[model samples]
Target: MSHALGIAWDMWSVGKVAAVLLVTFILSQLLLSWLHAVRAKRIDRKVAQLCEQSPKHECQSNPPESLPVTLITGFLGSGKTCLVNRILAGDHGQRILVIENELGAISIDHELIDEQAQKNAPSGVIVLKNGCMCCTGESPGSELERVLDKLLDFSQGDSASLVFDRIVIETTGMADPSPIIQVLLRSEMNGARFRLDGVVTVVDAKNLMRHISPQGPAGFLRHRPEAEKQIAMADLLLINKVDLVDSAAMVALTCALGQLNAAAKQLRASHAAVPWKYVFEPELDAVGLAQRRQAALSSDGAAHGPRVSCVTLTAADDVPLDALQAWLQRLVQERHEDLYRIKGSLAIAGEARKFVVHGIHADIQGTLGGEWGGEPRSSVLVLIGHKLPAERLEKEFARLSGSGRSND
Candidate 1:
């Protein structure tokens, strides 16, 4: 140590000590890079072996066109999963593959699956919790590529049905979206399979104030970057749980969130209840959602926990317009307060156009969407709430369509 340092600490000058420390840091970084490379090479070899043993599971010879990816980030208790569920439930004709990224070592979703179910889980991974799967693993350098390859693999020579239209990644409340963004947007390989759609941030209206702090330096917004940049760097801000607060409180929360990210679209939502169109609109489709995204790419990037139930009711036949409308109206009128989110698409009995359905507390609305064309004329409704009676709702939805079908 002395030989490297050149002098004892007591004898060393400030400049000399600083130089030594700088050299030490460089060496440490080099060592870390070497270690990472070694680990990555080993992972590559193992993956190669697996592919060789099972050629049908090999990565695609030609990667699919880039799929848009939406990153869902929020503070704990901020309703990230609620948003996720709403998206998955919506029959928007978009095949979305969701990746649930948890911060800690154990995956709550994985733990719930029994051994057989785990083994039978689809080849494409939907959840990669434990270190956000971005910053940890044997091959940090190519982990995202490897995951995407497996999920998008078309080894069976039939490629038409195996791809996803989009991917949505939900991060743990404590995660900073910055690192995840860097790993995704900055990588050349990631660009081939994915383009960053936008960053949607969910904030709890009633508890947002508790997480804010005085503005710090370096482009911190007036809402000044607290709650782990979950609010500050948002592209789309969902001021969720608005039903919990009064108008005055809502205004205050809205103003604070606006100051944090004035450029972001802010929507007041109760129970993450938002229409698929509004939530997934192509508002950012052009070379646009680009500027802010670029700035975010250049920049840097908790928890509440909630358990809820999701029930999906599907019927093969078309739903009678009157019966469906009456059913939804009654649902919102009588039980909307208990319902967290309700959204789906439907095929009205005689209507050629698809039907868009969405409802929040005390309100439900539908729009005549495009024709189903070759797609099945079926109705799927998803209900997310606490302690829901699945059987009753399922039966109601089935009766609307009046068809023999499986209900799960």
Candidate 2:
């Protein structure tokens, strides 16, 4: 009877211990769940606060170590290739990688890159002749991004020490740089690995007046819209073939360019002869850009003229991706001819990364940009088109993102 009693006590003790362990585990799991909820709330609050902040607010500065890139864009017959040759033949000591983006079967520029630049890029120049860098390919991201992905993989390159310190991209004559800039800005891979230093647009001075407007007797032909777009987006404008144009024509062309983009500094030269300093110049800091914007506001000339206009739309909340896509598609389809380009960093519901979107006329495409990281998770979009309904677009985007205000 005594042995039986001892066994009963032992069993009771074991039951008590088991109960304690179960209760501890349950409590721990509950604590973890609570902590996660709290963390999520904190992140949401941060996003809300940042959304209310200024657009010029700098979230995080680019680290000093990432390779810097200079993008060259221009209309056909502009000395863009000449400028690339100058860069390739430059005496700059840094190792460089040149990306020649063309739509043709053969890349003449790739062959035109002299042996000196090849010495800088021991792996040789990369040619992405499939299509324009901004246009959508079979993949979600731009073809340029795909090329960037491979080059940025430092471990997979030929040698650690021979890694390129700088990159120069020579885009096709008809290229629009806005989408390319959007890609660079949105890609976290680029964010971590490369810095898009700035865009330098080379203009054809000899053909400027002829392309700016219809000069023929009938006046049926329209102006070269791409020329103005290219000029407007540039941080620096290099007017090439200046020797071919008279002083009065040069002055007129310069004035037109300034009116299109009051922000960019202009230089005149023959054969794309620009200094190495301007070729690889960094973009203006936030303060400088703000000042430039102010200057543009105070200018006397009509900005962008009547042929083309650019509008910005911004909002604070996230929306369903499919609904947003459907709405945008219908809008783009209806206004395909009028809308030249559409690009945005969008906030999608339940998504961890920002949805970066690019549209050329009717062809709208999007892909996962990157995690929010340290930046504010607000939606900002740029629409470049002919006579855009800015106020209407602002209101629509505002309503879509649950914001009462519009940045337009």
Candidate 3:
């Protein structure tokens, strides 16, 4: 009877040990899961805070009554997007808003923030697309008036008050920015709601010569002369792509650019990157609208000279990727003399994606943007330059489409 009791006791002990082990395993899993949840929440909060403090967010607040508008301009393939991104990553004590004109329908800048979110960045990003404001017949003055009206409506809304410290307008790569500037200087909407801050023009160090010389691919928009006009109008000139060019070349380019526009401040940077503090400096002097009016009155060359010719080519069908690349390479190499800026969207055969291409002279860059959302549309290529023979350019494209290989 005693031996039987001992065996029963031993069995009971074994059962208790197994139960304890099972409970411990479950508790460990629960603890680990809780830790992960806490970490994720912490990260999300951080990103949200960063987003709120970004320059894009700060623009929502009204700028100084005297100076309120900022124009960010850059040539094709210059690091304008990079600079914008860097500015958005910092905290600049005010609400900011960005109006961007991307090369494609979809803004790649929005995608950058989305990508950061996936990697656990702590910020909320939003993209607003209403088509290129420049292309739209919407008068710049009217647009500003409409935007201010909307903002006021939002500010008075019950949900929450809306405010902005500054506003930034980023023009498209091919857009001539003179009209937009004119709107700011001459628009009746000019008042306490908005002020014209300054114009920042981004230049590519490697492509500056190509942009200015009639021999390069961009030589076609009459680009050399047009680019000079842009340089002349800028308040701050950013010389980007410094890494691709040597120091001597960069210095020479800087001096040349300075000579073109002595009134503007020139800054050299690689990737068009700069400190956020430099861009959103709070130092703004008050200037009345009447002063702006006087300046406009005094300026004689504010209007764009004559309408330049633009040649546009639409693809018959989706072209093969290799074929298109080869064709473009050859065209850029051979006809660099007549190309000002090549801007367009392309559909590559056999690929389930759309490609966006931008070129200045011989320098060309492309990427598979988003997937094909709608039916294949004809590719639109606009070549802007002086004395561009539409027939010859079209003929060359036709020959390339027929030939399997490019002249490369």
Candidate 4:
């Protein structure tokens, strides 16, 4: 009888231990749940406070009348997209949106822009993908108006009560930005809530001359006049790819650029990467328009005009980087006056990737851009200058290919 009583006592002890453990677990869970609720509440309160603190009619207010717009413009492959990516990646704390114009049918810039936007969370970005925003036509303009309408709706609607703080429009490489500006500056749209911030132009130091010319034997003389127009209209000019130009050429280029647009502020950059502070912190004023107008009026009497030209050559296959470099060096030495810029994508053998090559006068800059996903492509070299000899340029490139030291 005593042994039976001991067993009963043991069972009772086990039951008590199990009950305590269960109670502890339940209490811990309840505590965790309460903590989570508190944290969520705090987050909500913080977001609300931020919303309240943000300037009304700037980002959060409905029916905003004066929204800032930044227009980014550049030539093809000039790294405008890169700068835009950097700006969007920054911590502006305000809601932002982007409008991009793709050069080709592929819309590569759109993908890059979206990728950057996704990386910079919390800010909203929208892409208008029909065609170049600067194109003149019913379809393009209508599309732009529709996009603006949508943005307006967002600003007014409850869903977009926290609307974007800034809007950025990236024009196609070949687009003329004047029309786009006109649309935004329309007096009729004064109530549309969009304001013009400024036009930022990205200039490819290596290809600046080429972009301006694109037609001579060396590919720099063609369409030379239009290139000047682009520079003349810029509010802010970013001279990118500066690393590709030597001191002498860089100085000359800077001098030429200054002559081209004396009123616009010029900034130097490598890989088209610019500081966000300089780009976003500027207080765009009405004086810019006045300055531009004055510059235009005085341009007819200006003596110094753009002297560079451009030439383009397409290669059937990848050429060795070393060979191309040597050729470029020789060209710059022999034809520096006629050779302003050279830029293109090259396919190098055994590298399994594409290499980007850019040159300013005698200076050459190159880097590997990862493996090539598309089909085998030829090299496109755009040479910019005056009086470039097309035959000589071709012969030099061909000779470089023969040396078999092409890969670098």
Candidate 5:
């Protein structure tokens, strides 16, 4: 009887220990759950506060005192560089920072333009070494984010601590302007500092018709031609070299452009000669920047058809905190044929440095970037490809960034 009593006591002790362990585990899980909830709320509060402080009183709009950025894009030999130089040479009296992206193996536009300016150029001009800023990174540290970081540093280092009054970006002839525009519009850091003033497209009047129609004698029908896309996105269309085309041809071309983009202001000029003020301060739609952001996010590249589309994803927290690498690897392996270009920045978890991600076709990269200064660690990702699974990709990014659905 005594032996049976001892065994019962031993069983009771074991049950007591098991109960203690189970209670501890439950309590620990609850604690973790509470912490994650708190962190999420904090992030939401920060975003809300920022929105409240914004001049547009919306989370997605630019600050009232943000710098203005002018984007110049066009076809090859369409006088994009020439237009940029003209703006630089003009007596705008505002300090300007120019970002130049080249397409060839060697960059010569910056030097050529500087030489042509003959001391009338802007305060500083930075030439990007990548072949094309729209889609040039094989790893992280996207060309766009790197350029923005540099701009921030430069603006801070200036003696007056005064950022340039104006910033101009000249894209290569063969680039898609949509990604560049998205970067300026969606990037939290960029929107806080620089507002998109206008998009000026320099059209080679001689070749404009040839590009607009694939059946023209030149027959330039690529899968995704940049010329038509450039025209489609232009706020101001400069039909350059009008002398090459007769008045009747000019009228016809203008009509054709109107059909493609009725909203854009069409102008004719010889040698890209247009008043700088027109390019810099065109009458933009009166909607606040937040409304503009909504329009941009909803309608970006919508008319490009199903064969090619651009998917942009945004996140409020840092990525790679979870399985970012595994997810990206799966993306590249599964979608190499459809993936064309990828670029953006990430706010790393528990780190001061920002992570930049870039991919061109199958080549993908992610690299550490500079620290975020007084700005929330919001992340942005832009993808240009054919038939992308945007929903799945967005979900994965949201999971990585710790935002439940989407950032913005």
Candidate 6:
């Protein structure tokens, strides 16, 4: 009788265990089913919403068309801010949102610009503080989704009609654009909430040579990989600061750029002044986007091969016209290799109009800009190069301008 009792107890325990397992499986299945149903409904709702916004078309079971996203990338000090500012200040007839990623502890780039312009601007700015979007050894999907949710909510909520026309992401100078591109591609796969329109890269025409040239042993480690990746991934390349480089230099740079990224469409500009339509509304075909994606993916990690620096000088007084011209000519001739770029607004004696000057290597140009503004006329020049004699250049400028004083 004791043996019989033991067998019955064992059977009871097994039955209880089986019951618990069955219940748990059922609960898990139910949860998964509910989640799948929720996802389906959400996708359906998005599809309906997209149909409402767009022209009447046959709706397949696929996800809706996503918000267009334009990525703007470049190396450090490559006029990215100027390009973004132009987009914000433009009259594109549609609202835009900008995602700004910075590499420093604090986001001072936004504060340095004019607040009023931003306040009145068409684009609403969002900043990702402290870290770069690409280099943190983490996927950008979660971070991007977190910020993009705001735009999604605005569009999908009660105000469905008020949707942002497009989104722009301005990456940090040190950022690798491949990871960022992958993030958007993933988002599209999950649901077409965001579609990559194109990548617009700003190349500093004056400093590009320095960034691309081969570095020696001492400087090899100092090269920038991000710069090369940026060029490789660009669908639209803006060779900015064109005024700084002469025609021959421009031709040579263009040829080199084609070698770097043959797929990208190139545009030349000064002060990032390309038309908003060209940068924002590029003629992007499916093949073009795919090619650009492949180009980015194919590049194994490579560092930027050049070392460059920037030097800025200011003159508070007016300079003689002939002296200014001769000084700039001589400076270009002497420091052509070391001098990558020079741009400035000069206050010249006996001249009603200000001289807008740009210099690249041995090429120098000075054009008469409009009249001076309300403030006193002065000369402000920014020079970029591999190695520059900052103090000597400042003193020479002072001597030429007859100011006896210059600030950097």
For each candidate, give its TM-score against the true structure: 0.45, 0.51, 0.42, 0.45, 0.47, 0.46
228 Cα displacement, candidate 2 (Å): 2.5
Model 4: lowest-lDDT 10 consecutive positions? 130-139
**TM-score leader:** 2
lDDT of 1 at 184: 43
lDDT of 2 at 259: 49
Local accuracy of candidate 6 as per-residue lDDT tens digits, 225-308: 568667766768999999888877776677555545544678888989887778877653323423432443344433222344
**Candidate 6 — what's its lDDT?**
0.62
lDDT of 3 by residue, 381-403 (tens): 55544455667777665554453
For every candidate, C-alpha RMSD to the true structure in Å: 19.7, 21.6, 22.7, 24.6, 20.3, 23.0
TM-score of candidate 5 to 2 decimals: 0.47
lDDT, residue 75, candidate 1: 85
Per-residue lDDT for 1-408 in model 1, tens only? 876676655556877888999999999999999988886676545444333333232457655456677878888888988887666555567766666654332224554233543343444333222111111122233434333343334322223234457767776677656544543443232324455667788988887775663334731243323363666445578889988888776656665554344335677789998766666652421122223223323433221112234455667888888998798778877776556545556778889987866444454556787778886677666564545577888777778777724232
Q: Pairs clashing in candidate 5?
A: 139-365, 140-365, 140-366, 140-367, 141-356, 318-347
**Per-residue lDDT of candidate 5, residues 1-408 (tens digit):** 999999999999999999999999999999999987875565444333333333453555433677788888898899988876666555666666666665332234553343433343224433222211111112123345434444444444332243357777777788877655655544343335556677888899998665556454445454336776777667788889999988777666765655444435667889888877778876533122123234444442313334445555776656664477787888889996676556556677777977766555566667677778776667766665667777887787777767734312
Instruction: Please report how far candidate 6 places residue 308 from its true position, in Å.
Output: 20
Candidates sorted by TM-score, best first: 2, 5, 6, 4, 1, 3
Candidate 2 to truth, TM: 0.51
For residues 1-408, could you state the per-residue lDDT of candidate 4 as single tens digits? 999999999999999999999999999999999987875565444333323333356545355446778877877788877876665555556455666555332223454344443453333333222211221111233334434443443454322543456777776777766555555544334445565667788888887765553534766345545456556556578889999888776666665565555445678999767766566554322233224334433443213334533334555656776677676667767875444444556667557766765444445566666566775555555554555666666666656545321110
lDDT of 1: 0.57
Clashes of 3: 34
lDDT, candidate 4, equals: 0.56
How much does candidate 3 score in TM-score? 0.42
Residue 350, model 1: Cα distance from true site in angstroms: 51
